[model samples]
Target: MIALTLRQRNIIEYLLSRDSYVTNDVIASNFEVSNRTVRKDLEVISAYLKEQGISLVRKPGKGVWIEDKQEVLFDDLSCSYSKNERIVIYVTSLLLNDVNTFMTLASNCGVSKQTVINDLNTIEKFLDGYHLSLIKNQGVGTSLEGDETDIRRLFIDLLFTNDHSKIVYELCINNDGIQRNLDVSFELITVIENEFRFRYVDRDRISIVLSFLLNRLGLMKTKNSTIQSSDMERINSILSTKISDSNDQEYISSFLLGERVEGSLTLDSKVEDEANEISEHLISSLKKIHYFDSEDMKDIIRSLTVHVRAAIYRCRNNIHIRNELDEQVRFAIGVMYEFTKKELNVYETKYNLNFDQSEISYIALYLASIFETGVQEDLKVVIMIVCTFGLATSSILKSRMYQIFGDCFIVGPYSIEEAEKYLESHEVDLIISTNYMSVKSTNVIYINPLLKQNDIEMIRNTLFQESFMKMCSLFFNKNKVVEHDYHCLGEYISKNDVSISKGKISWEDAIRKAAAPLVAKGDIENKYVNTMIQAVNEFGTYMVITPKVAYVHAGKDDGVNKNCVSLLLLENEIPFGSFNTKPVIAIVVLGICDKEESQLLNIANILDIPENIELLKNSKNIESILSLHD
Candidate 1:
């Protein structure tokens, strides 16, 4: 035979198995390799086949096929046995079947007469253990004789001496065939005859024959086997007269034949009593191990009942095996039932206590603590500006503070005494007192009643400086921005119109018209401008335009607190020279700020561009900006 690589051989074998030809593309796709590699492997196989007298032909654009052959040459190479060894076994078996003429037998097996004689000598050695003799006459064929029973028994023992005997015994017991004590190694003839008769008989007759044989033969001896004490008890209980008396034989036979057994009240009562006892014990043990709800417990009990009933039926019907073996089977069933019962108990207990009230309370507190630690430290300065009356100045201060600091939880407008009382028990991290009232201690930072843009800027810088960033890094890295800050900004843009409009106005005029009111109120200027510039540099380039309502004055009683701040992006930078306000082509400023204000201030800080504002107003493309919410 020509030598071939494993891959080439595999390819050849695959082609042989197919009835029709396969394309090279189909084979390449199936193997997930390049077509070139597959073709190279196939070429090797084709050359090897030709050398071995087999022709492999391929038709262009069609496929490959093997040429016709009178005999399968691969089969000769496939067999592991030598040609002489194969002939020896074939000749010997033929002779044993009563072929007398040596020349004819030799001719039939395709071997010379001398080879047949050589094989006969080897056969003589093969039959040594069987103690049988082969006699040959000059005119007649060879005959096998001498203790045929012993010879058959020797063959049977050889075939069944290992694992097959145990498998056959199990098969017989499970199928409700004749139950016999499988302990003895009887003569092969006896076993074969009995098996033949058993196969042809009815269920009752088979059962009777099995019972008689087991009783007559006695128990088989098992050595060094681990048989537990409880196993013995279970076997006794199953084979006891109360459960399997002779009077119940008919019903037992019916049950074994896969038919429902009825008729005997005594038998029915006994089986039911045993099943109920087992079911009750399983339920009680399961309950102790775990807490199962009523419905779940009931389902488990139903399953246990089915298992017990099946076990009882098997014990009653299986009479071919000895009482000891039957008890062992029942004991195994009992152990399995006990194991299931314990597991169900544990499951019930664990599931019932999953989310008790105390657990929920702990979870809520843990979540609150997580939120406290995760909020950006720079945004944590919660200032409440206290004034005599709840009016314009307080609102203006609030808006200005928000524009400077990204977030601040401001609580304000309380009287001096009211502020002191509220701060006594409430959490006030920082207090901004606008009025010159005598405050309690040094922890409070008092600013002038008329606040300036630089003052607010200094406060923001001091609050969220280097020390605060370090503190924030302890809980979370700088790469992870807070979701709530962005959420607040997006939500505010969604509810307001922050669009810019084209006009005959200079950028400085727009900035003054928008920012001048807040600036005059001691709220805007360099800090707000710098903060807006920083925001615009970080985000993309944008254009800004003046709003039509930019000139509207805001007051406490005007019922129109025009603290409107909008965001817009433009395609190009409109020509504006550097006069702080010139680069900022559009302007949006709040007249007054209050606690109930929306997110316009944050959006303005995020997108600080005059051209962008103009584009946004003209295009009304708020959806793209607002998509940050998702």
Candidate 2:
């Protein structure tokens, strides 16, 4: 008897999996071994194969291959499965089929009981991800423990790893349970698709049919799974099979009903009923949460009805949306996001449903779009420029301010005495003077006669602060006006608001380091950092708004002590998620105050400019970064 080591088996398996010859270097690299070791391994395998009338050929540049003309020897070797792969398959079979005993798994997988026990350790790790466990009891032998929905989702994920083609092939290809009945299911799908004038993704169509067949064959279990009586009768007539059990019709019925909503294509009775019910509750919840316009209430309700229907279908099926604009949308519509999530929570509680953050983010995106259309124009910042450098210089400064701020501010050039007189009568948001002024109002910024990039940043900060104060007054405090010294990006950067991460770090660590300066300054608490990280874990890299930049922020309610922004630059780029092609190099942690809100549009606008983004990514000094606005 011959015993093969795991490495030898892996080497042979790797070579066999490939159609062309594999280089010793590639094989060694894959297994993390030296090329010499790989060559030695090949030599040992070659010596053994020669005795069995098999040839191992090694071309100079092409690499190594097996040339067994009879194909008998290699075919035997191909049947050998890795212990780990066998374990996964064995556990999957146990979870899905009637094979529950340790003995059955061992026999089915051609492994020893001890080997199966060792494999269980690895299997436990895999099941832990789905919050599931593999338990072996004296009476029951072995069983899986988890929510039925989560367990099924885990099974599907393990089976197909997001590949729908493999799902169809595994469940429907020449299988005894579905081999005959699939034709009837196919006909049913065609009839339904045509009658409803709705299309189903081929993958989803096959899965629906497969779910029905598997449920019927007793290979899979669907908890509380059912179909309408009318649908059941129609399906039974089409198949001419007496589906005596009501449960037998449920899986197909739910799938069909879900498919109609998932596509958002058909407005049939079933979809309409589900959509209206969910949308009415959602809209009512939103209205209760905040004051909004009722002018386009019907249109808004209709849009929500269709969206919620689709969202419900997806949530149940564990389908996720990959929203690229999630971070930007969340940042821009900060309060609205919280409002939308709270409203969705109402629906979740009522229906016993779970909506992932991505779904909530999608809803927020739609709401933000609708809300933006009705945004009341901002009250322009009124500035009275007091220039010590006479009329010509003051006029130039005023013109430049107007050029830069555009509609954001109303700039007026005035002498120091004239500014005092104007301020006595008119309410000015800010005072920009060439020389230092002993003004009564604290809202004053001093800049040089020649406005530089740094000057624009300062002016932007002043205006942003004023806008934030207004928002705070409107939202939280209506009595006293909120006041705070305006801090520009340059001041923050120069005041050591930046943390440069040197080596490879996790996204969580990157965020923590980015926000550490603010945390140290009592701008935000530790809980806020954890909350931001948790949000990323739940919703993915929706925070990565642009390449090399991530606005890592959670809701204001999540431990925000004050409104602040800190920047962290990474020397080594780290991958965020599917959203960015380039790895993230900058993490801008935004700590938003619960009582006060800042307009992210200005920040977004500055970062939106490619040149500004480039400067932020490449610059090491505050001066270079400020030059971006110029």
Candidate 3:
């Protein structure tokens, strides 16, 4: 019997049902997949049908179809087991059969012995991640041997990756098993969450960790769990199944600490140093390539630093997130991603992180986030006015200089020697002097010692164009001043996000509804909303930023797949916190990813004014919200 993937089987069934040919576009559209994927599926289906003496016919412009196929039906043809499923069979069989060989394993999986060998070769690579090796005993068939901690983490991760694999693994534990305390794991997690005041990202993974821990407890003697005594007391209370003797307790604690984003475990202080060094290097390297020297780079660096810390922690623990932007980021910004990956090579060995493809995707995206927000402002001219004149004359000259050179810097009346010393150290754009200073610089403007109008005109004529380029050197450093929409912070809010209340709803519900549009649009992940509520729970109603409006958000790390903002208007008031007298009638949920919180102050501007709040309530239009910007 030929094995087919789920998609391959689906394609065969679709073709068999259709009397006429289905075009690639039609198949792609119907399946909600790309045309390229449809083509690949057809190729697989064609090979399978060829073995069974049937043809899958296709024309480039026309379509694809299976002609006169009566022997094959969906029910008769079984979907092939996935690789993870095959792994479950292999590992579970090894655990069950005392003297199982490749031929025996092949018989169990219903695949060729040669196929089993190939699968083992691939599975070996995966076990390498856990530092576990597939060892073939001289007499016994095969077994996994490595550190007990790695073994526990490996089983937990396998269960997390595929639920189907769990049933097979459970068979090894059913007899003389800890099935009586299966629910104890659930209770433990709940206790830990409430006791610790943090939510684990993958509850399912944690449950599997606890279950595996129970199955392996007392099977062998191991080292201490390495978990703190204080934290382990809570675990011991939940699972008094002699868990004290087991090291699985610490792995569970470690898993809990690693999975949660907000209450992340305190890593070595060097982690922060490494993240900062990497961020600075990326910034420096990017500047060299003309990627950006823009003002947004500062925000980019800060957010990237935060992400790098989390990525390093995840990498060290062998936790991996499948970055959605992995393919697109690599495709669009391959050069930048390559540069970032190269810069990170220095830390890989020290941290034991290869900078996996997904982590690199996010890092590259942050580097790409460095962009020009607006036109670069003119350069500021830092002027050092050299004055050999008296104090009263210097004060007059300073005041006069300020009045005349409105946009340029005015540094004093240094003695000729003082001016020369200052010129060597500081980056002065222009130098104004009343006396002939023995300066070798070209920007020195010699002026009359006495107060004269021509001196002012000469200053203007000599550096008028340069003075126009001057901005406040203290605050705006020429290219540092990013052009902002000073009048309105309305760029992010639009009609797609604005929603009127169907009726009055709970503040929590209102936030979910406000953010639901973004969730549905994939602008944010489903976890983003839960994190928002968690934020409000952890902190108070500081989310309620204004009188009748509330702006709520969690850090971008909590599950913001993209950056977005949404607004919900309520006809009735809902109290966000202790502000009963001033109940919030509007809610705004901000979803951000690997970026700065750039939208809050602007959204708050809308809520700050009474008229704008009224506009949001009365019109309930996106344009109304957009117009409320300062």
Which candidate's TM-score is highest?
Answer: 2
**Candidate 1 global TM-score:** 0.20
Question: Which candidate leads in lDDT?
Answer: 3
Which ranges in model 2 have alpha carbons more than 4 Å from their true place? 1-88, 100-113, 122-184, 187-191, 197-199, 203-242, 260-265, 268-310, 316-498, 501-566, 570-585, 588-606, 609-630
TM-score of candidate 3 on Cα atoms, chains taken together: 0.41
Clashes of 1: 21
Stretches of candidate 3 exceeding 4 Å from the true structure: 10-40, 44-73, 80-89, 92-104, 112-142, 153-182, 193-202, 218-242, 260-310, 315-332, 342-357, 365-630
Sorted on TM-score, best first, the list reads 2, 3, 1
Q: What is the C-alpha lDDT profile of model 1 across 1-630, one tens digit per residue?
A: 555543555567667766766656455535533455678767877777777678777875446766654433554432122344433334334322444566765654455778667777666665655676667777786665555333433333322232223322333343322333322212221342243232221333234333333332222221111222332333333333323443223322322321111221122334345555554554454334333453634543444454343334433432111121221111112122223333333333532312211112222232223323334453365666676636677677666666765566667756789888887777654566666666543124455455653355335433532223223222222212322344433555423444444555543344444454455445444355443333232211122212211111122222324444443332323433221111333344443333234333234333333343444445545465554331
Models, CA RMSD each = 35.0, 17.2, 28.3
Q: What is the lDDT of candidate 3?
A: 0.62
**Candidate 2: deviation at residue 174, Å?**
6.4
| Model 2 deviation from native, Cα RMSD in Å | 17.2
Clashing residue pairs found in predicted model 3: 387-413, 487-630
Which prediction has more favorable lDDT, 2 or 3? Answer: 3
Q: Candidate 1's C-alpha lDDT?
A: 0.41
